[model samples]
Target chain A: MMSRGEPSIRLESVNHWFGAGETRIQAIFDASLSIERGSLTILRGPSGSGKTTLLTLMGSLRKVQEGSIRLLGQELRGASQRSQEALRRRLGFIFQAHNLHESLTARQNTLMGLQVHGPGGDAARQNAAVIHILEVLGLGARIDYLPEKLSGGQKQRVAIARALVSNPEIVFADEPTAALDKDAGLHVVRMLKALGRTRGTSTVIVTHDTRIIELADRIITVEDGRLLPG
Target chain B: MTLLLHLLLRRTPIGWLQLMHNRMRLVAAVAGIAFANLLVFVQLGVVASMNSVIYLTYTPFRTDIMISAPSPQLFGGALLSRRIIYMALADPGVADATALHLGSMEWKRPGGMSKVLIVYGMAPEAGAFAGDTITDQQLAMLALPNRVLLDSEFKDVGKDGSDMAIKQLSPETPLEFEINGHAVSAVGSFKLGSGFGYDGALFMSDQTFQRLIPERTSGTLSHVLVQLKPGADPALAVRRLNERLKSEHVQVRTAAQMIADDVNYMNTEAPMGIIFGIGVFIGIFVGLVIVYQVLATDVAAHMKEYATFKAMGYPHRFLLGIVFEEALIIAFLGFMPGVLLGSGVYQVMAMATDLPLGMTPGRALTVLAGTFVACALSGSLATLRLRRAEPAELF
Candidate 1:
């Protein structure tokens, strides 16, 4: 285990490719960036810019093939499976699609975030934590409703609650507001900003939403699989 | 235990919830499983019924040992010489012995239709039969020439014999029939049921049997029934008789050995048991396929959701657990209806065929265990596709 350090994430000279032989194509090239504690960063890029790939690599969802990525002060280059799993536990992820289990209710979906830690603590406390997060996200009345019954924005809120309920040090979201209306999108971004200031939880989002771009503390742009000057 | 149960209940029942979410798919999967179970139950039931028939057919003759020609099937071999009965009586373990003559002949019914009847010719004494309906009085009735005892439960001689134009024969409603063109009178009745090969049975004295079938010689016999003395071991007596009659063209066996031999012959030599066994295999295959389809489709439908779970660091083991849970649930749910409906079918078949066919605890447990294992195996295989749901692709 490595000691805690400043900046939730640090990447240096990261190079990644897909496939092999003649079919091989590079996806990330000599990219280096660092995200600080309690900061909201947005990854902005055009289509086929490999922005999502960079996000996944930093989130520990993808292996660092070349260079070094230190997530939470632990180097992820050639890391063992166990260490990777441990790193993933300290981070949360949200996709462009809400990806909520259609069978589970909003409260149940939120509870899954805690469930990943395995059985620990009292059931009552877990239930209280899940309920508090759902209510905080303005889903108190619809907590018992399944995903199919909720609107697009409400489901997105449930997803957000799921990511934040576990008290993760950093969160990575890809286009988290694409399905929401203008007001809902703005409200979600402001909520993340508030959480960053109050809890010191860092966040990195990938989106082209103009409203979200304006609220970002930092913006990184990628074009043709290469990071440009921020 | 309470704490464990509480913890278990606290965990979200994702598998059950997912299965219940698709009502139509669940119904189809369950129906497919039930149909497969039904097929297996009926096939096994039919084979068991055949065994029951053989057991019941031999239940009446209460002899300690049987000396007969070396034939696998009963009443379908070369006739044994009556000297084998005399040789069996010489054994100190044997109390007495009697020769039984068996033959099958076409009997002309009242409506001019002919049906085959199995004839059992024995002496006018109670030495051969045990405490069956063939009592001294019934044997005495058979002593008179051309007089025989009819099987009251006899329907007909063949599969289509039940359609014959003859009322169910009882002692009170005596019927006259001709065997091999020889006129005979059925003055009494017994309770031996019809077997698969013949429609009915007739009991007569050796003299009357010779008169009905003139070609049968008096010295030739089908079986020699050996009655053991009090406290005599049948196995020892049978061993002694086989040794004593080793020089003769005959075999000695206890009643149980005879039944075992017959069952083995029917299962291996005849096609009925083999065909039914194949049916059971086909049933299991069908059930496996149905469960696989349901689980695989479910995993495909929720690929993205599973990917989300992976990204959440839930581990592949947890996802595998959910699939297994669904399989066990389906197994339990489908087995109940399948067994219930199977028992009902057994009752209907028993009533229709008059065979001792019913569910045994052992059979039910075996099938239940088989179903659980098969479903679990299918569930594990179905999760292969789930492993390919890459969280990186979710973007």
Candidate 2:
């Protein structure tokens, strides 16, 4: 898949530490990896193996230390918060907990994703985009239901819809299937792969599930904080 | 500008609806603020009513000066002679001087028994009425020598049950009571309170008041009510009178000065003023505190939600704008109930209340406006925590 290599994402010797001096927890230890564009890349690790840290670092959730990280041709090592947020907008984020705003309905939450990405306050565009995404997610019937009202799988689907609705160049899902049953979980992974290939959005899913790792175009394993050789 | 308004409105849909979900808390918040507003309105209204009560002395009988004996502060010692009545009138600057009787009388009724009645007796033809023609009740008693003026409530002034219910006493009737035993007659009676207590005053010529209380006639006249010519200065005349009466125990005061003194005396020297002041301080203090607490609590509960908005690219200015909107809504809502409750209180006080309760439209408006401002301040104050919540910390 990476014949001579075009990197969709490139991290060079990234070092990240958390907390301070004596209490410092090294979340990432000189870790670096690259993935080709238009491919489904899976980062396989234990819960605290820093797979999330790697995804966030690649997504520009935090500034890099001791490294040059390029995401979608944008240099992230010294990017400002504004530039980083803009980079984040170009990537879809699906969290484990579905961190959707509870006050808003499921449909409204999906629409919020469109609102955040589109030229702000384009009501018609936001509505159309949300309608299209919900229909694709098979959530047309439960659009008006709140997150509490929706089943765990439906919530995850809404989260997936939220993630893909923006048509981001990168879709990074951190344990999106963690909270679901086996069937719902595989269904989400299948949908993510299908949406990635069809939309041509580069997908990077972090999971401990062996079942989903097999579905990735490339699966990279990590022991402790270090990536194992493919 | 338009964009700012639009975005703020769109974002606040959550915050606005949050208030509606907790109806009891919202009602409690509004009721607390409104009660404070109402307290201020009622206090101010009653204070205004006190001023309205004095229109009789201050308006119609526009007397320039009043010369009262025993000096009103120690009001009971105000006993004087009727002899100087004509001598004071003789002065060109005086224009005219009327001797008035300020004393107590014993009156007896069949059911109510005998009680001391306070009387303000002046000439049958005095400036007390300003020139308004006598009402029938005032006219009936004036025609008879001892026909006492009775309002809807006719008090027995004589205390002796002699002419109970006045089967209409004749012109030459003499008052039987003795005040230190000086002879006098109960001549003509006019109307009761067409000036008396919380109700109206009963009018009678000086002779009738003197005859009823012989002890007062022998003293140097209770009070000399005087009117001056249009061009004359009452202050100058009062100064001259004060100088002349410097040797005697008397006070010569202008009507305006007397009214001011009366107002100041009541506000400072009376318990009513202290109560009114306390009520006001308590109202403002409690209202402000309640508003502050409500705002702070709401903000605390919604801090995470607000932080999410802030992290989602919303500016601090937009957040501040939402706070102001919340403040405006809370304050305005709180103010209405307060006004309604306060007006209800004002109505209660207005009926049969000795204390004048008046709500000047301007004062009412000011109180409500003050409620709004206090709420806005509290609402803004509640947002102080937003400064500490970092967007990163929020996530």
Candidate 3:
């Protein structure tokens, strides 16, 4: 059983590569880190610095290649695809592209986050939960609007709602506010920080946005696939 | 099963939403599938009509067993000795035997253009045939000298662009035409539609038939139709008749067996039947291609969504469910229009060719099942592209 003070994410000597043979290029090299529960951690790096790759590995979205990653009390190295899927269900992901299904309304998109949990309780209650999350994300009025009808910032906010609606133990966000203005971006980061303080939910965000850096409880930087001494 | 239902209820709506996202693409995809379905329906419809006519030729005959020469050809076998009928009757199970004389003659229209026509000659008093298509009154009219009942469905075009069968010789008009140089009036009409081999049919008495073509000997017979006594098994009676008529150069078959043999010969041996089978194959092949193209495009458009689902802890099977759901919807949706349009085409073809082209519930169900299989196959192929969507790649 995991205790309250246990780290939400733990990595040790994690290594990853892309391609094969002469074309093989290492993306991450011997990275090790631990993220405490209810803390907001931000990964800062330039493009191609392997920050996104490290986040994906930690989030259980990608296979751990040569090292161990333990998330939410499960070891990820050499884990079966089924185990990885089960682990993924306990985590949340927000991508830079804000990959919301265009055909679904904002409320429907948010409901997708809960779908992986399968049906439980009353459907009305589930809908109420989804609606409440969207309202809290400042998307209350746009709940019924499609992605095409909403602006880029609204779409990103909807993505955030989707990632957060399940009350995931940890959230892995890749440039969640890359498309948002300063105020909207800060609002998103502030929401993540407040959720950490209240719900004991850990958050790991990968971004170049310096404005939200002060809000992160811990800041980690990556350069050339190697962690920089802070 | 509960799990399956829950999975379906959960994933199918997403499938529907994705498909409905781009209305134009959905329309185009459905249209493509419907076109494929139409092709298969029409081809199978032709085969069904061909089988129907073959069976229709035998439905009017009231017999439990039929005796013919070995390997009977088109109209029937060669003339057999009447002693065979008496031999069949020798069996206590045989109630009665009727001799039918079947032949074809050139029907010379008023304009001197001739078409081949099948003729059935039986004694009007025998009343052996058992169909309401030719009423007792029509059969009684056959007793008159040189009078025959014409098939209402027979159609022919004349040099003057008039319907030779309808405009010239209708029951009300009663135009006299020459069959084998014997004058015969169209006394009444029946509903025996034409088959592939002949355009029209005429029912006349045995005496008139012998008179029209004096070549047939008085005792010669084309087929001997035998009915068993009540509670007697036809199969056992056929076996006894085959044993008794073994030396008479006659083959004994049940009525159903005879019709089945005729249908089998048409489907397997006849060139026209082979062509129809080839058409059905071509239709299925073309349908598969069209559906594959449509489904492949759909998968490509939704690649990103599939990746997102994978990242959300949904299994590959879940993604496949969505694809198959889209396929099933298209299958059923497209089948409705295909059947409707195919039925319309059947009516047009039946009118134009005078063949008994039609749609039956069984044939419709068969085509629907085929459409589902075709779409499912296309969905399976589309999954190949879906496999490329990895959540890791998405990052």
Candidate 2 per-residue lDDT, tens place, B254-273, comes to 87777776666555665766
Sort all candidates by DockQ, best to worst: 1, 3, 2
Per-residue lDDT of candidate 1, residues A1-230 (tens digit):
54555688999999999999999999998999999988999998998898999999999899999999999888989888677877787888877789999988898898888888887657688889989988877889998899999998889889988998898889999899988888878888898888789987889999999977888999999998899995
Worst 10 residues of 3 chain B by lDDT: B159-168
Q: In terms of DockQ, which candidate is strongest?
A: 1
lDDT of 1 by residue, B266-378 (tens): 77677887888788889899889999999999999999999898888878888898899789878878888889989999999877876668998888888888899989999
Q: Model 1: residues >4 Å from true position, as ranges?
A: A73-87, A119-121, A197-200, B1-10, B90-95, B105-116, B126-133, B155-189, B227-249
Docking class of 1: medium
**RMSD, every candidate, angstroms:** 4.1, 7.8, 3.8
Query: How would the candidate models be sorted by TM-score, starting from the highest?
Result: 3, 1, 2
Ranking by lDDT: 1, 3, 2
- What are the candidates' individual DockQ scores? 0.63, 0.15, 0.58
Where is model 2 more than 4 Å wrong at Cα? A1-95, A99-103, A107-125, A156-174, A180-230, B1-12, B30-45, B48-60, B63-200, B203-270, B289-294, B320-327, B333-337, B352-364, B387-395
lDDT per residue for candidate 2 within A57-166, as digits (tens), equals: 78766668767788887788888767766666677778766766665677777765665543356677777888888887678899888787998888888888877777
Q: Model 3, range B117-141, lDDT digits (tens) per residue? A: 7887887887856456767877787
